[model samples]
Target: MTPHRPSQHARRLVAALLAGSGLALGGCHADRIVNEAYPTTYQQRHPIVLSEGAARLDLPVGGGAGGLTERQRQDIRAFAADWRKNGRGPVGMMIPDAAAGVHSSPAIRNTLAAAGVPSTQIVSRRYPVDGPETAVVKLGYVKLKANVPHPCGLWPEDLGHGGGDYYGASQNREYWNFGCATQANLAAQVADPEDLARPRAQSPVYAARRQTVIEKHRDGEDTTTNYRQEDVEVSEVGGK
Candidate 1:
């Protein structure tokens, strides 16, 4: 047997293969240089949306003229007051047509007016009621409300389907449904949706408190406040 060695061309080919592999690895490193990421929770990104609330109030058709009782008048007053205070759009009083077997009466108009709702907003429309019986009157208005279009508690992947293989858990990230219900509840509880958009004007400064602080500072005494703490009863926690 005779000793044999790699030819020049063979050595050159091996070197080319090694250089190609190095170039491929360098390309991969370049891609990783700009791969910065920040995983954000769905709750933080998707806040509650608000809309103008609108609905019609169905008052008894007979609650007009002398037909309206004292209780009915009180309810109408309350409704009108609320609409005037919190309603977004024009508060309208819709009267049923005479052909509907009920006509707009003086009592209905008077009750709304007494509550400070203007008379110019009243309008009338008729719809075919199957029976000749009296129909209910409608008062419609729009109010502010907070809402979220997408509901919570959706699972795109099963938990135990692949032996606890979850992307959120693996990445130490919050689940998609986390804090969604809390956000929705907060939105519904908001009295005014506009408050969420902008802060209200600051209240006037407390003159008495300001004077006390000023006197203390002038006398070289500590300006820190001694807060009044009263004992609060906690019995209600276990009560009915």
Candidate 2:
């Protein structure tokens, strides 16, 4: 009994050794994390993706037994131009199941045809109307659209809460929502969504311009073209 009791000094030594081991392990873990390849760039975190989607427009039909009004005609013509530009497959029309639709359907078809859309490519279907609500002719076509899959405005982790320590701002990394709005805006504003993934076909070269430049270069003349500035100067005080 009480023959072998560890002294306080021995206990302290054991505690110190354990603390040093823990620190060493923690250092190794931190190094591993730093070395791992992570998606740190905003572009990588929020990528613009191209996918198939629909471009739609609604044309309100007037109750009066007449063809589309002047404004409606212009709107339909513009919508038809868009379809001709980027539409895929057949251009679809979801008309209300009413007499107005029957009356305007032929006129709409004629307008679309006049705008270069083939009659064969125009498809129409009827949707039942419950009551005397406003009837809208829904025109839709499939097209390539760019978007971000991950929705914005979601904060999974509190930016201020740094997971006790060695996280969040301490790591000096981007948050989840960073560059999301930029990516979304770019996707929305891009004229051609497919351009995000790959380049389009090159346009035809300007033969006349190319020939002029070549002639100038061969004749030992300046190849650059200078245009005349015809606009009047706002201020001529500085020897304009």
TM-score per model over all chains: 0.69, 0.77
For residues 108-206, write the lDDT of model 1, one tens digit per residue.
Answer: 787888898887766545555544455666778888777776888865545564645365557555655667888888888987788988899999999
Which residue pairs in model 2 clash with each other? Answer: none
Model 1 clashing residue pairs (backbone) = none
Instruction: Report RMSD for candidate 2.
Output: 6.9
Error of 1 at 103 (Å): 4.6
> Please, what are the lDDT tens digits per residue for candidate 2 over residues 101-177?
76778888888899988999988999988754667788889998899987988666677654532444677777777
Model 1, stretches more than 4 Å misplaced? Answer: 1-39, 44-46, 63-65, 98-105, 132-134, 161-165, 220-240
Question: Model 2 clash tally?
Answer: 0
Candidate 2 residue-wise lDDT at 30: 84
